[model samples]
Target: MPQTERPVSMIDPSLLLRPEKVYDDKPIEAFRDYSIDDSDPIKERVRRTYYDMHTNQTVDFVKGKMEKWLKFNHFKSTVKDALIKLNELVDESDPDSDLPNIVHAFQTAERIRQEHPDKEWMHLIGLIHDLGKVMAFYDEPQWCVVGDTFPLGCKWGPSIVYGDDSFKDNPDSYNPKYNTENGIYKPKCGLEQLMMSWGHDEYLYRMLVHNKCKFPKDGLYMIRYHSFYPWHAGGDYKHLLIDSDEEIKQAVLEFNKYDLYTKSAEVPDIEALWPYYEGLIEKYMPGVLEW
Candidate 1:
């Protein structure tokens, strides 16, 4: 069957899922390289992280996570404090960056600020997009807190980082109800309708909503789906989408370029830039918040 395409102006839908593919002068392929290399410690770490994630992130596991975290009871802190805590986390699943997650957050936000100068909400979205990784500080494993997320209770996408080999031991892969293309979802159910695997993307998205952060729907969409590479980047899951997901997909793709491609960019002066971002926090989502 022919594939459905995202809007052409956003990004070409024909590009192969190659980490080495260049965008904005940096080789993005070098960024997401998941090639198995026991000799390369970073590559090995990336492989192991995904293998663990794919192996263990089943429907029940995600449900348990939701039950645990969705209560917003984990802890309370301002957005800046939470983001600062990420300075201690190095995303084991990422091949391109070994720097503190805080750096990547600022890199993404600053890049967005440059490109879309007037959209202050988008700049904040870039800054806090991965802020949910603060879960690592609370005892959650990196497997659940980092990396790309796909819908649970559905056939794993072929474009997922490690693909089927990594999910060999996952019970979901063998379950008839969860392994089909449509899985438990009706046709045209839309991206929002899918139960995404437990990860920072969903955590932060929900936390924002729970705390009454006032980001617009597209900003929220960018936060929630930025790491959903299989749909926005790989063109998978077309069978499950409604027509409106097209706009959501475009928003995600727009935010995703800065999220992925900025890892190699020069780190911004995070301390210097804080005053501006702090104002944004006060304006949008201020004060101590529930986890």
Candidate 2:
């Protein structure tokens, strides 16, 4: 791994200034310049992931997964423990640099910490936002644990990654019940009632809710929909959302700047940073969680 020549504390979140700002110029250039058009290289890794997801993420598949993972009987882990363990996996769906995820965790936290130092809860949210992706570390395929998520039972969103090419293999793509816009859901059925495709976002959202973590609605929203690029980033799936959902959508959108933009070749000083995060963990979600 390449470390920045300057101290990591001065790392810029978005705007690149001096040449020394880039640890590896390639990913930073992609981060700064690449578009998500059909031809972009970012779509290369996303293609296979969405292909498998679109094919297998049927209503029945999501139901079966919800029954299993929703029980929250998987294992016991604290927030800190789970976030640290999340480092073991890499997100194939991510076009960003494939560093251990703890770097991203801290990178996100530090970015928020820099901008809104008073919103300590937001800082914690940034750090553990993708800790839900630990599902990949637990034998879950990269396709399921990480990706741009959309609702499973309803008609697929046009902005979903690989919107056309991938869903051809999906059974739901043909099933008349799921083919139409609105499918089984009523207009403005609300995101809470719908089952999103089984992924770490849903997993961690359920975990936090079940554990009774005293986080604000925004924090929870950031956790759940951070991967929901189709809804938040792509501007698709507005029919399913109610007025209140817009608040959460804005929160997720603001959170996305840090989550999507913070990837780099540089890593955080984990040893120096661990103590502060442990303190935050104790303050909020202390003790072993039945994750």
Best by TM-score: 1
Cα deviation of 165, candidate 2, in Å:
1.5
User: Which residue ranges in model 1 land beyond 4 Å of their true spot?
Assistant: 1-25
TM-scores for candidates 1 onward, in order: 0.92, 0.85
Error of 1 at 262 (Å): 0.9
Please state the error at residue 105 of candidate 1 in Å.
0.9
Q: Model 1: per-residue lDDT, tens digit, 1-291?
A: 011232222132224544445755665434566666698898789889889999999999999999999999989899999999989899999878889999999999999999999999999999999999988888899999998898999899877776788899999999999999899999898989999989999999999999999999999999899888888878889999999999998898888888888888887888899999999999999999999
Taken over the whole model, the C-alpha lDDT of each candidate is 0.86, 0.77
Off by over 4 Å in 2: 1-29, 32-44
What's model 2's TM-score? 0.85
Best candidate according to lDDT: 1
